[model samples]
Target: MINDDAQTRPLFNKIALIGVGLIGGSFALSLKKARAVEHVVGLDRHSTSLKAALQLGIIDSFTDDMASAIADADLIVIATPVAQTTKILSSIYPYLQSNTIVTDVGSTKADVVLAARTSLQEKVSQFIPAHPIAGREKNGPEAAIDDLYVGKKVVITLLAENADQSIELVAQAWRLCGAIIHHLSPKEHDQVFASVSHLPHLLAYALVDDIAAKPHADRLFQYAASGFRDFTRIAGSSPEMWRDISLANRTAILEELDSYSAKLQQLRASLEASDSVALEAIYSRAQTARVNWITAIEAAESQNKDGGD
Candidate 1:
């Protein structure tokens, strides 16, 4: 249901998308579907992606020129990899409007915040760091969907210099896209995601790589079951993106890796000693914890659904 009222008085007159990948294209489509933006301009190095976005009606126009893309745009979304944050911010800094509100969909926030601080300097407040906790094992503009963020968590990590108005406007933009907004400090965001998100992806990739390197790799894959597929589903994600994310949040990820390694060691010791009781105890505790977590999430989702009505 498109809101005609919102169309008549959209939140943003023009929004410039710096990358026409899954996140950027989805944002454009979602905003347009909600009638919360009058125009979306895509700016990406890859002409193919921009063309695809334009053809799909994700963006009203496409451009490779930074100045043309940012000029008069009320909001700018940097949807590139975390590795490109500094470069993108630096490129757009010269063309940013006084009232421009810049945000990103980067997976890691601390590095992005540092990049914004370095590139935007005195105007750093204009760039708010955000991480949308929604994605598939896919990439590119063609993979984008308008409802990708529906009911998903989008974390906004604020800078001390950010004004109240700017913060709310950014939050409202995500709200229009049907995202539930959450706030966290940059350090907190990175640390939390490093444990839960980054580590899982890393483990999945590692597991697949380990299996694929064996002489019986073909035989193993041939007989692989649903559990293998489910566990390694995220291993199919873009290597470039995950590489950048892992490097960007290496400090927190390394700490998490060490903690996880310690736990693995404990499990290995239990197995070596044939300690069935200890192994069963550990598995029981983990099962109980996961069940509680899932129950809490389901309850929250139900509450949110009821409230939405």
Candidate 2:
């Protein structure tokens, strides 16, 4: 299954991806595009997903058998939904090679780490909890694109028992797919994502649902402008996936919700008192801060490209 087009050898002999959904498929395709792996063997319980992955050439081969799929795999990516991650990892623990490096694309890291620690036990050293901060509202293999992770940030949660080689290998795989890596403790990763990612999705779903419940909902939606579209875009995300993330990171999410509620109360009081100056200042500061952040990010990206060249 090895295919090397140049002098450099492939980084992995085989990468066993346990899900054929957007994240897993995109990673497989990206690795294939980079010729970074000799073989990508996909495993999924869903027939449609496996079929689509095979037809689209996202994987070199696929299997429904857990043991067979991961036999001698140098790297294993557990890309199943957050809820199923623990069960999947536990099932594949015995099948993984001694040197196999295990990583995941789950949005929440604490629950995943707990699952690995409890299920994998001593073998947990091979498991490196990771979350690639990339993807779309869309789902399934058809929604996967090769460059979905390019230039995106991937956060890896380092565990106490993890081997240095395992961490390096997992990070190297993500680097091959053009991702910038960041490290955090599993707790820190969960808290950070709850504020920036999970809470927003919950807000979007609430906003969309609130509007849909109105009497003239259809008419209102039809007349909605880019503002509404932009704000509620993530409402179209996979409910199952978001639900798992919300619950898995419930503690941090609840804290964030409380903070947001307090902020909203202050904004509400400002509006009630007709404090136009306060409102204007808030909005103006947000605008400036966002623009500055964007400019800095773009400049850094340009610098990175120039440096790479």
Candidate 3:
């Protein structure tokens, strides 16, 4: 029999990571960082990815089969594309232990919660819909870093079916990964990210697409500076992933797109009329708002660090 101390020491005896890309890879490394889990078994269909993760010491073991990987895992993290969650969760449902806890690192949560509800039925209490508001344009196991979630905002979308213990464990795990937990309903999570995350990505893709369609586009891009690169960075993100997020949060994203379109039309009108005051007002307001946001975030981070110390 396992020692009582050993059983209680590990936050989880084994953590089964369903998708060993950036998020999932980072999660494994983070648990190791905090000494939270005794073992990690990572799953990815990519044989090369599994090998690389094992070589990098990101996982204790790796596998491609869904059911066998999660058979005895106490915690399951499904980090696949948002659109794949339903299918993946359904496939793994039969193998999950009744005491196992499930969570996802999807960008959107409303549909994820729905997927869990429909797939797990009465066992929905075992799943927690979570989104870590962090990532780069780069993905895959190679891009994973241990500190990626440090000081990041992790939103937990509270569901009616979620049990108190399940919620606490999910929240505590994120905290162990050095994230600050925030609670929201699935609807609220989707709406908030649709504006702040999805809308910006859509704008970036549109801007790049329009720029590329211009005559002598290559010449124009050759002269592009930091401002262009910074604004369009997200346009370089995975097309498959963004496509899923766009459709998954379609209603809220469409609302944001329409609002942005109106703003663009207003800016165009101001430029056409050569309204210097209006243009300056828009620029000044944007600059002020962004600077204020940065300042507030920095202050919060400092406060959190100080409090932790």
Candidate 4:
């Protein structure tokens, strides 16, 4: 029951956030701060996260029952892990209002879009698939912050023409959360994120596993430096969530993994041959690319802030 006068400001009457973890809690905080939602209700399988969200005042009310939580929600945000999207959708599909707009924060889009299309075709027009490219190694409601998505990228994948209204509402929601929204086809979204997001997670997991498999693993770990620590920080992310993402985007991930393997083999050959020229070239290219990417990201953030102002 948000103020009716706020209705013209992209604020919803009620927002039901399913799975109140980091993303869900962040959404709630942003909505409250922006006065975008009159009331926020939450649902989560974990009692600890639900309690933390409540303690943080991220939600007005919460429940374990999905239907009860989303009954009259004008906006429904599915913030569960990618694998849980279908299951959660099934549980709440029966309770969704006709005009209720649903969106997700899952990393991958194809699987989620297909799941919604198959299970809730009648309401699929109200469904908008989105992925907020903002997160930290830390998770749970306790780690949530109001500015988590500030100056970050949010991808919205719209497959059906009838989803225009839902897409606009989803974009407005992210805008209120201080995010820049980009529209991409589900296939394009999966392919792009497979390399940028999925592959990085895989690399982090593999790097940690490789280090741990060494004969003197403890000795190696003891000597790990800032670079090693920073690169592997995401390896600390929820294994259950990463496991789902890895499996869901298996095709694209495998392709990228193969490409990475080839590069690794090339570097190994160069090192074995004492090919200083090749090594220097590879290192120099990587350094330049990293610098350029950092510059571009900073510029984007600046532009986003300016636009908001």
Query: Top TM-score: which candidate number?
Result: 1
Residue pairs in collision within model 3: none
Ranking by TM-score: 1, 3, 2, 4
Q: Model 2 — which ten-residue stretch has the worst lDDT?
A: 1-10
lDDT of 3 by residue, 69-116 (tens): 888887999988889999988988888788789999999988898899
State each candidate's clash count: 0, 0, 0, 1
- lDDT tens per residue, model 1, 1-309: 123466378888899998988998898999898878988999988898888889999999987788988888989999988899999999988988778999999999999999999999999998888999999888999999999988889999999999888888889899988899999999999999999899999999999999999999999999999998999999999999999999999999999999999999999999999999999999999999999999999998788778666
Clash pairs (backbone) in predicted model 1: none
Candidate number of the best lDDT? 1
Clashing pairs in 4: 2-38
* Predictions in order: lDDT: 0.91, 0.88, 0.88, 0.86
Q: TM-score for all predictions? A: 0.97, 0.95, 0.95, 0.94
Stretch of 10 with least lDDT, candidate 4: 1-10
Model 1 misses residue 262 by how many Å? 0.8
The predicted structure with the larger TM-score, 3 or 4, is 3
User: lDDT tens digits, residues 1-309, model 4?
Assistant: 223465575478788888888888998898788878778888888888878898998988888777777788888899988998888888877888887888899998899989998877688888888899989888899888998998888998886645566677788889889988998998899999889888998899998999899899999999999999999998999999999999998999899999999999999999999999999999999999999999998997788789888
Query: Residue 150's C-alpha lDDT in candidate 1?
Result: 82
- In candidate 2, the residue pairs with backbone N, CA or C atoms under 3 Å apart (3 or more residues apart, or in different chains) clash, namely none
For residue 293, give model 1's deviation from the true position in Å. 0.8
